[model samples]
Target: MWEKTMPINEVRELRGKTNIFLGVGAIEKIFDIAKEIKEKGIDKVAIVTGKSSYVKCGAWHYIEKALKENHIEFVLYNKVTPNPLSTQVDGATKMARELGAKAVIGIGGGSPIDTAKSVAIMTLYPEYTTADLYEYNFIPTKSLPVIAINTTHGTGTEADRFAVVSVLEDGKEYKPAIAYDFSYPMYSIDDPKLMVSLPKSQTAYTSIDAINHVVEACTTAVTTPYAVMLAKETVRLMAKYLPNALENGEDLEARYYLTYASTIAGICFDNGMLHLTHALEHPLSAIKPDLAHGLGLAMLLPAVVRNIYSARPEVLADVLSPIVPELKGTKEEAEKAANGVREWLEKVGVKETLTDLGFKEEHIEKLVELVFTTPSLDLLLGCSPIPPTKELVEKVYRESL
Candidate 1:
């Protein structure tokens, strides 16, 4: 097998796509930002967030204090849930519109931020419902400016133009929807101070989710030279710091590295696109909305890695070489890489199977059906290095169970 290395030209040519403000006290700076927006004729902004984490972490109070101190007018829609529902996005959009919000501010993890992305655009296109936001149904043409505050170290929703929302299509079936094109946050505040209060479980799960993002991106055939190099570093950082964060949630340095890793991996996967793991994980979380997105991905990634390694060991070796230096650039490195991932997942408390996450055997058929029928399937199969057949996807799901 050929050894892979980053080219100097690719490193020189790579550019930062998103504007990020990171460090302690970054949320306090939002006051000036709000004033800047108001000066631009955007009188009021809609703050979209989840119910608990921000409030529990003090980020919510910090944001409200900033807006109030700056005399910035805003409305709050804090009902966003995990695996945000289309109905929730619709309702939030309507609320933003009725409140005359000129922009959207998203706080919390990926779901609310993603909902804010949808709500910001939906506020602009009142004619387009969540249905039209579906990949096959709509092409987003316009969006309001969005500012993202990431309280969790996962999803990198703040760093990309893409957002994922779940919709109940055909009245009963749960499916994931994605929208892109200038829907990214105008700027992001990635303050590790905000993540200091994050629970150990969230730190573990979200960090693993970041790891999945890089692994999928680096292994895919369409991965760009710049993204591959970035993902390698992201994976290395995750391997080094995830356990540290989990062991001590207040380890600010570890938290910063994990948060930074999420941003790097998010950008990498945003460009390279994700494959079977994300493809299968979506239906599980979409069906069971209460399930955590990272947990679902965690349950599936090891199994997916094993499948990918079987078919394309070289790809696996390329991605895992940074984490498990024992890869040594050989086909045999695939099993070593896969084993390293499984062992790490266990160490990080991601040892759950689908059953452990409340999924049952009966759900497998429905999930397979959704995979084949949903719009996500096209993107999934297209990016997959191996030709993904129904039997293959189902087999992986069963094995994961």
Candidate 2:
């Protein structure tokens, strides 16, 4: 038996419009959520999930039981894959509309939850395509209720108002993120017990993704003191607990703090917004389609940090000190700080270059072009502390290679 290392034994209902329930046994809240929705006259809901995690993480059993025991009807759409495509959302939306699903339950990590968010919105607008929504062709005013059951410790889609989907246009794929007030889940659950079965690569990559969230959030042009404080704590928790979780997947204490880190990182970005790293990573995954979002972010992190370090050297140094202990808050130490971060990522087994991932030197210009042209990516670039010029974007990609 693992000894508890933190005060995570009791489930706490976090205060927000989202109604976030967090702790070890928080999965049980699905029963109460089912009853509440039933009382609202919502007899049916649509469940959007990936192929295996919903069942592997042991969340589906409880969710199914809750819906059945409460006499709430639901249809399961489990075809959502990683780097979710707009077409998948359309399919799920079609099924939900046919069933008259009044709410959507997203069970898994970011992909399914994000897909669920898109389905919730598109179900309301039967005539619009996801491309229309993501490209700002139509401004989304509202969505059906969303209940998120997160099975991964990264991509806090459960807490944020953002949803990312890749829309294929012509022959190319454009992955753009959309954030709307109504996209926030009406209810969300983060239970550490549900995350104990995550694979090792996912364990490392997802936490790194969480770390990247804070790094960009704290260093962005609109960064606030509140975001910076949360960024520091997020980095500290990931640096300390991630290794323990990787070593023992069943370490609930490690899972608890990592889950907390991911949650706050999501809140941090929702408030401070993001900068070059996420802006740049989107195009990478959009181009490859098979690349994991977090892995792409990890590959570009060092290069992006090297470019933006001079913009807020003191804050960057302080926020990254947990992983890069020798970093000093000075513009002259930019290369040293970036190298230290790269080394830390390697120590945690995320050693991969753009070349290793099949990107060539010839691909640099295309990535640079996509950063400026992709929907919402230019907006993210505007948040960077440094001027996101074409040459600077090109240089970041070259350095990563």
Off by over 4 Å in 2: 1-5
Candidate 2 structure quality by residue, lDDT tens digits, 1-401: 23254479789887665778899999999999999999999999999999988998899999999999989888999999889998899889989999999999999999999999999999999889888888889998999999999988889789999999998777766889999999999999999999999989999999999999999999998999999999999999999999999999999989998998999899889999998998888989999988998899999999988988988899989999989997779999889888999998998889999999999999998898888888988879999898989998999999998
Q: Give the TM-score of candidate 1.
A: 0.92
> Best candidate per TM-score, number?
2
The candidate that wins on lDDT is 2
Clashing pairs in 1: none
Candidate 2's displacement at residue 337, Å, is 1.0
Candidate 1 ranges beyond 4 A from true positions = 1-15, 310-312, 322-325
Please state every model's RMSD to the true fold in angstroms: 4.9, 1.8
